[model samples]
Target: MRIIGGKNALDASSVHPEAYPVVEKILQATTSTLAELMGNNSKIHSLNAKDFVDEQFGLPTVNDIFKEFRKTGA
Candidate 1:
């Protein structure tokens, strides 16, 4: 579900070809990080979607995207 969302978002963004790998890496890392955080936590049933987004925002992919944007002025 998350991967599908990520891919859709990426597709909609029209990011540069060179940044595709970076974006994909970020998506994978974000998924794993969230999985690890949720691991074996039976008591945890609900989570704020914003919190997951906040975590992903801190990933290096954000910086990579910015750099790509700067390079291309896109």
Candidate 2:
């Protein structure tokens, strides 16, 4: 799902729009679709939060993203 009038496609998710790039990076690293990641705690757990860290999104943000994935549902 996407935000009705939002610029960032990730706005519909628990993840913030400003963190879109972080989500993109996570997807690329995991080679998984958004659908595949959502609500998949095991898969999300497999990921290393540190690996996804960057200047914009630090370890806490990445960990938050992982938390979002664990709880987000369709």
Candidate 3:
């Protein structure tokens, strides 16, 4: 491997061939879990990302969001 650059930067290259098999196995395991959790709906998904944003992030209601930033607050 070669490392080059100043304190503010660096460059990179490919990993050794021997490491790919291990990475492939790890990826295979993750795919099955990902499929089960993220695919086919499978009778789940009662709520989604938008629901999370509305529930947790709490939409500030157009008025609440821009209110103070606008002349309303002024």
Candidate 4:
């Protein structure tokens, strides 16, 4: 769920198209770093890294965009 009354919540600059590339790069680096530190534990590693990104940057799943589109089409 989204933060209530949260600012900086949008697709443009809040999480823009351009920034996706950078974010992916950072996520990759983060995963690699964690894997190196924690070793090959896929479940724990993925969850930990995902939690970090979600907490810090807020990762939007495919459903988020689809929901917005559905609402706007009305």
Candidate 5:
């Protein structure tokens, strides 16, 4: 679900709002946009979640972000 009045950025995934920054970091590291990444396990498999880990979002959260991107829908 998306936050009202927000950009509806998380509208299509199971990812938590707190993890958006992690997602952004992942997107920046990859060649694809969010649209291109979603549900594409081929792309997701190439990602190394450890590279995106931060103080707030650790390995588990980063892995979850990877899983969320592989989902076909919310």
Candidate 6:
């Protein structure tokens, strides 16, 4: 992964390719649930991204992810 920020501006890190599927699944599930909840609704003009993510995805933390990984022996 590449990260760009601050004075240093850029940095790269490595991640296992196997992790991609897990991340993709999380994103797909989040977006699908969000769409279902927002179906036929046009009044959401001021929803905060953070709040929306939290509400829709339950704001999963590192510990939660780790717990899931352990549960699945991943």
Please provide TM-scores, in order, for all candidate models, with all chains considered together: 0.31, 0.81, 0.24, 0.26, 0.82, 0.26
- lDDT tens digits, residue span 11-72, model 3: 12122333324323323533633223232343123323232233323333321222221221
Please, what are the lDDT tens digits per residue for candidate 1 over residues 1-74? 12334533444344544455654554464553322422223312232223323433544545445333333212
lDDT per residue as tens, model 5, 1-74: 65544565465566887788888888889967888888889989998988998788899998888887777753
- Flag regions of model 1 displaced more than 4 Å: 1-11, 32-74
**After superposition, candidate 6 runs with Cα above 4 Å error:** 1-14, 32-74
Error of 5 at 8 (Å): 2.7
Task: Please give the distance, in angstroms, between residue 74's alpha carbon in candidate 2 and its true position after superposition.
Answer: 5.5
Number of the top candidate by TM-score? 5
Residue-wise C-alpha lDDT for candidate 2, range 1-74, written one tens digit per residue:
45654664466666777887888888998899887898888899888899988777889888888888887662
Q: List ranges where model 3 is wrong by over 4 Å.
A: 1-14, 32-74
What's the best-to-worst order under TM-score? 5, 2, 1, 4, 6, 3
**Candidate 5 accuracy as lDDT:** 0.80
Q: Is candidate 3 or candidate 5 better by lDDT?
A: 5
**Which 10-residue window of candidate 5 scores lowest in summed lDDT?**
2-11
Candidate 6: Cα lDDT at 19: 41
Residue 66 in model 1: lDDT: 35
Residue 50 lDDT (model 4): 41
- Stretch of 10 with least lDDT, candidate 1: 40-49
30 in model 5: Cα distance from truth in Å?
A: 0.4
**By the TM-score metric, which is better: model 1 or model 2?**
2
- Record all residue pairs in model 5 with backbone atoms less than 3 Å apart, i.e. clashing: none
Residue 43 Cα positional deviation in candidate 4, in Å, after optimal superposition: 18
Scored against the true structure, residue 11 in model 1 reaches a CA lDDT of 42
